[model samples]
Target chain A: MNNPADLRYATSHEWVRLEGEIATVGISDHAQEELTDVVFVELPAVGRAVDAGDPTAVVESVKAASDIYAPISGEVVEVNPEVEADPSLVNTDPYGKGWIFKLKVKDAAHVSKLMDAAAYAAQIS
Target chain B: MISEIKSSPLEAAHVVLGAKLVPFAGWNMPVQYTSIIDEHTAVRTACGIFDISHMGQFIASGPTAAAWLNGLLTNDIAKLGIGEGQYTLMLNEAGGVIDDLIAYRTGETEFFLVVNASMIDEDFAWMDARKNANVTLRNESAQWAGMAIQGPTAVEVFAKVFPDETLPPRNGIMTTAAGAVVCRTGYTGEDGFEFFSPAAEGIAWWDKFLAAGAKPCGLGARDSLRLEMGYPLNGNDLSPERTPVEAGLGFFCALEKGDFIGRETLARQKTDGPAVKLTALRYLDKGPPPRAHYPVVSADGTVLGELASGVLSPSLMTGIGMAYLPAEFSKIGTPLQIEVRGRLFSAEVVKKPFYKPAPSA
Candidate 1:
């Protein structure tokens, strides 16, 4: 249930860490915990353009599939192949190695509007 | 803003163990305790205990119970000796499956039926509509709590729990001294037994099994285990629109035995062949797991059918599912494509079971 204070999150449970013009995106720990076992992840291809609120990826558990929505509109700069190979990384370290994709921020200022760790924590609780 | 959902007798135990509860068929049931793969693996390698109390239970016993059941069910009830259980189907007049259940002959003229939770009300009404004076039908779901202890090590765990008792053979029910009926049956393709006891003692049994090393499994692991075995789930794999023949469960439908509710249509389908038969699909290439309602299509991309149930098999370490496919493309090794989130993944029609138990050393 750790929500790093530095990270910003979405109402849909995605978390983003922005540095300069790049934003690293993954689901929150609460999201991974709710999903239970992570068996497969379908990440957006690198360089794909995505809008905020758009489904950018899919995380599948043994029971069902869930869409991972983009927190901020941007072009995908890179994808995390590690979580793709072993989906449990998302469950084990959702805020770290489980980072799904990096977005080249189209509007870096828009990231500020998302909820902070405390706000996101309150939203889930 | 919300109405109440029924909880199992072991709901408190699930909460103590930190289970994730979800609404399933009008019941607040646990979907998982830990991860699904972890629980699923435990059932395959060791033993896992599941609270199946949401399923419905009914007692039908009287002067003409056996005869009435034979007409109401697809299986030949006359053949089932006392203590023996057989998987059977209740069907609509058109041969569509109402629900799949297991009927256990408990005495010379007494029977017990276990049916899907979602269909309990409808199933009861259907049976009652055909009821006559000679039989008594009672809905006993509230009085019992059911638990499935399943896996390779299930026998050992049962022995540890009931040290002095001998479990019934497969498909047999042994009434325990404590009034619990232990049935040598399970949904997972492994050796195990399902225990039905008075509702009040369910939590105690759940805790005792957990203390004895049985993993607390939820519906998530249950889905994956049964999917790997190609077992037809009531709502997902079998439905009022699907017949037993189309579900690849013709063996359970005793057509020649006598006329049942849906025998005419089933017999015709058996002779004419089902247009679309339930078949198993295994991923030929690794990708996102196929899920329910994902379209199954041909190489040319024409939609043939949709996946009835699909999951990433914890045992096979690959995606597996059951779907209705045209009889022409239902053979083993037939190449097929499953459309998952707008992408077609390579898959093939495989044998029913995507996993098999390891041979004993």
Candidate 2:
């Protein structure tokens, strides 16, 4: 699976898409593939404060548990309940409907420091 | 991941089917193909096959084989007739389980023993140190590859694979013309057969079984299937710190058969009862699934013990797990709590086997 060209990625495998002040976050396709058969997801609550690289959420597969990290500093404005109810979406459509949470950027310029799609693709490979 | 993890003969086939391979018990084995729940449900409903080549297999033959085994194992080996098998356990002097295994009486003086993969070296060394001059012990694990074909439709698939052969009945083992040992047994609660063949032949059979409509399942589904049946995993539920008395596997341990390795300790535990008892539990509140090593506590906030095995039971669609709790707190319907990631959730001690086999029509 290829990382979406429009999104920025973190070293921890979370992808971020910035729309004005709101930054949407989800795990990379490679991340979901590694953690196969995701049975449950615990999304961080809306209004929670998170800094870049913070362990913000959790994804659990049948075999193990992994922490989802924050790519940039922000306050969580909304969390995707759909992904929480059906965690497999993170595998099927990781970048779109499977977006985990949306954060109101505390520092919009920090997103520029995140890795590009090509860089993430190289890092994972 | 261990750098020296061994790969099974079916490794190529597993990769071709897009299985997620992981290191388990020093073997690089497939953990899942699609989703664990999907593969688990397939076995419970239709059919599924697993590559269980990592487990250890041993052959003991000679005039003294039966008597030596009787001295080593907790089960009544004398009662197992030719072509029959019995579940048994090897215990430490203190009555702690070394490993749980199945011993098959193939001939008048020959027996086959199958033990857990991780405990192969330990089990062998322990037995080898006490080796009798009359018994011959051979480790056949590296020479053979094993497969478990399971479910209600397993017989049909087996028939398709061996069109001219007769399958063994439950608890029976037969050596095939192609040098494969077919045992009418499985870990999944469903009716199935476990086949062990030469490494090369085993890979071919795995492919043929898939072509014949048997789903290629992995260790993930195997764990859930066995857990649903309340089967105790060797390293997890059965450990050096636990005995058959606490595991609720006393039926397999026959004290009346005479003195075995841990006979005295086991007899004392049987009469006096054990301090810890294994119990089945299901989550009352929906949240993240319980996992091994998670703390299991009493209603009054007393820590009982840690969960031994846990999973989001695919068949029951609920969180199910097994834990060794204090005997007083192990009663059915007793309220308990599980602490996962510092959050407590409601749970209860329930009956054995969270999943039951459907009644035959």
For each candidate, give its TM-score against the true structure: 0.96, 0.96
lDDT of 2: 0.90
**Tens digits of per-residue lDDT for model 2, B1-361:** 3347799889999999999899999999999998787899899999999999999999999999999999999999999889899889999998899999999999999999989999988899898888789989988889889999999999999999899888887888999887789999999999889999999887788988988889999999999999999999998999888899999999999999888888888898899998889999999977788999999999999888999999988887678899998899889999999998888989999998899977433
Residue pairs in collision within model 2: none
Shift of residue A120 alpha carbon in model 2, Å = 2.3
List ranges where model 2 is wrong by over 4 Å. B1-3
In candidate 1, which residue pairs get closer than 3 Å at backbone N, Cα or C atoms, i.e. clash? Answer: none
- Candidate 1 lDDT, B70-154, residue by residue in tens: 9989999999989999999999999999999999999999999999999998999999989999999999998999999999888
Give i-RMS (Å) per prediction: 1.1, 1.4
For model 1, the superposed segments whose C-alpha errors exceed 4 Å read B1-4, B359-361
Writing each residue's lDDT as its tens digit, candidate 1 over A57-103 gives: 99988777899999999999999999988899999899899999999
TM-score (C-alpha, index-matched) for candidate 2 = 0.96
Candidate 1 clash figure, as a count: 0
